[model samples]
Target: MFFSVVENKSMVNQSGKTGKQLKMTSYLAQEVRLARRHEEILSQRSVLLQQMETYLGDKKTKKTWQTQAADAAHKRNAALLNDIEAAEKKLQERVYLLPHPDTVKLETLYWASVEESLPKWEEFLLGRAETPIGFKKMKSAKWNISYPEEDSQK
Candidate 1:
């Protein structure tokens, strides 16, 4: 006796055993690559935005900064000019105050005359034997060292 069994082709089930698994892995790898590329592009854009913001911030302050600098320079120049004018005026005043030798000699002679001609009554009234004579008081006291004609000639 001989026996035979015929197999049915429809009895096999794939259930994603081999070929589908390879395809899914390949798709996951492609997705990861795309995600990394997008992250790199977003980072570059953020860096460019920060640089543009810095440039724009400086542009907004341009006019006021230049005006302040010009004002400071003008003030410095004016102060320097005032200091130079003051120094020139001081030099001129010093030159005017300098006493000539002839004027000093005449002044000495006038004071000597007043010292010699002091009366006893005037000395007693003032309570001091001698007093320092200034130029203003000497002129008012009729003390003269030169002739009227000679002074008029000068």
Candidate 2:
């Protein structure tokens, strides 16, 4: 979840530690991509196994041909399983290389402090002031604001 928060380029740029933030973002993205690839490989293996099972179960197929097909399918599945294991190991390695969550949180807080020290920082603050208490709770806030271009005719 913290990784997802850091994926925003604006946030990373505002952090004042652009290099480190970008590096972390890149590694997190790579990890997510690898995870998706692992899932895809697993799905492929599942489909292959299912097809092989169906073929082998067909009553019309000759016994000798079925035996040969089964052997080939077994080898294919074994190779796929090996691939899955390799991917799992790589994923684990990536996870191990990531910084501790608490460290990341501290870094994030530091970035927030940096932002808070900048001019006009109050304009970026969330929550409404007119509430029974100090401020009304907000479900979400948008940090990246864009203004429309002014027309030359105006």
Candidate 3:
């Protein structure tokens, strides 16, 4: 798994699964919200349809107009509902060791990249020993750290 020491930055840990569950939870929440929005829009359209039917009633005209509006609303509703179902399917397909969304604080969007690279990270380390690297194998490496620029910079 991986972790972040600050906001909007993430580093993969041993298995690159650090914020995986949190990332999934965030994505699922987004899908669910979109689904709910669709449901709300459908509800609103239904209400408008009923109102129009009541207003345009002249017996024969009532049947024709109501049918048209209902048909359109039905199609749109079906599409929106399908989106919800697809989102749910994705949510169900995934499995994570630590599925805690409660822990997400600073790094919200950053974890998305971390989750994306997790499988590759695991594959990369597959040939290595199961246990962590021994001190004997340690080596020094160069580093180039970045910093946020101040507004005072022209």
Candidate 4:
């Protein structure tokens, strides 16, 4: 009896205009499925973009973002070198002649006289009798050594 009832139910479900309605409903289901697929792709793209943004926002990546950092460092180095060179030029420009008047005038009265200037001048030019004039002597034989004969023989 139950089997007969189930067969009757199936017969009615397959009958009349419901078959055409079912076909239309299946078409709508396919459309909905396609729309859902598009939504899933868009959602995945959004998630990927968010992940990329987060990666770009990291401190190290943000700070050292490009090869231009090396260029900027090189520019800074060049500017600093130019500044150092300019400062050295200014220092060289102000360098005065030897017997730098300010230093010698304050230390000695030798520059004051007019007539008896020869001996003080010689002493000043030739250095004191105690310390001979010329290049400093090597503390040890750690450097090349050479001595020229006295100019009187030449």
Candidate 5:
């Protein structure tokens, strides 16, 4: 999931940075670096995929890419693909710059009030009191995704 503070997008696209946007520039720089790395990995993975496709399409060239070699290459390609996907996912999470000082204070207070009030009304409003269970399930569901080895290391 991607999250960003307000005014972040305009700051990112602007060439000339004002005092408030300097932090955003640095955040954009980090995102750019990650994006480049993601693209490079994707290109490398694409080549491997194309090679596998070629091997699959042409049966006459069996000696060129043997069965065992193709299987090994397929494993390598799968690993590379996983890496590419991970990188792409990382690219989605960016460092968002906070808005101006006064705006921040105002928003903070507003959200604090919302949080303070939410719990009291949460049950009545959040429950599917009138709606069907199936409809609510279709609208929202909990998700859990695992990266076994990678998550263990972290």
Candidate 6:
């Protein structure tokens, strides 16, 4: 469900942004929206199925028309299931077309940034420094605190 967009060599050229980039961006943006839509469709299908089950399981004496209604419900459910399957397949295809991010470079840069900022954070925590500019002071309750157990061997 996590969508990351990295420039694919095939999709980009030396000059500027290409149509493929725009298409990829559009698809990435649509991915979440589409996923939510799929979930809604699934929910609708489930409700329909539950209703059908309830109707068919009723203890009342079966009327001639009840059988026809049940058959129609079954047909509609089958059609919905088919649509869901097709949508899932299409989603998979769209995901397959998405370019994967360069995790190694990303991780390296992330760690470098963290390393650069660690000293400032440590100084602030130690009370020797004021709250760093551009950062708000968070409540103590917002922090997760854990203490290491003392070694019994010691």
**The candidate that achieves the highest lDDT relative to the unseen native structure:** 6
lDDT of 4 by residue, 1-154 (tens): 1345445445434346344455567879998999999999999999999988888787557577555788898899999999999999887776643557767886566545543555544665576543334436677867755557655466
Residue-wise C-alpha lDDT for candidate 6, range 28-131, written one tens digit per residue = 88998999999999999999999988887673436656887899999999999999999999999987885456765788789999899888788888988887
The digit string of per-residue lDDT tens for model 3 on 1-154 reads: 2434552146335665545656766889999999999999999999999988777676668789889999999999999999999988777765354456765543665698678766656654796434333224334443544456743463
Over 1-154, each residue of candidate 2 has an lDDT whose tens digit, in order, gives 3555445544546547655567878999999999999999999999999998888777446787789999999999999999999999999998899878999899999999778764343544534323333345665556545556544445
What are the runs in model 2 whose C-alpha is more than 4 Å off? 1-61, 111-154
Root-mean-square deviation of Cα positions for candidate 4 versus the true structure, in angstroms: 13.3
What's the lDDT for candidate 1? 0.71
* Candidate 6 clashes between residue pairs 3 or more apart in a chain or in different chains: none
Task: In angstroms, give how far residue 58 of model 3 lies from its true place.
Answer: 6.1
lDDT of each: 0.71, 0.75, 0.70, 0.69, 0.73, 0.79
Tens-digit per-residue lDDT, 1-154, candidate 1: 1112222223233663344444556878988998999899899899989988887777767767888889999999999999999999998998789777899899999988867755533664587655534323356457646788998999
Highest-scoring model, TM-score = 1
Model 3 TM: 0.27
Model 4 segments more than 4 A misplaced = 1-17, 55-79, 90-154
TM-score of each: 0.37, 0.31, 0.27, 0.33, 0.25, 0.27
Which 10 consecutive residues of model 5 have the lowest summed lDDT? 132-141
List, in order, the clash count of every candidate structure.
0, 0, 6, 0, 0, 0
Which runs in model 3 stand beyond 4 Å of their true positions?
Answer: 1-17, 58-154
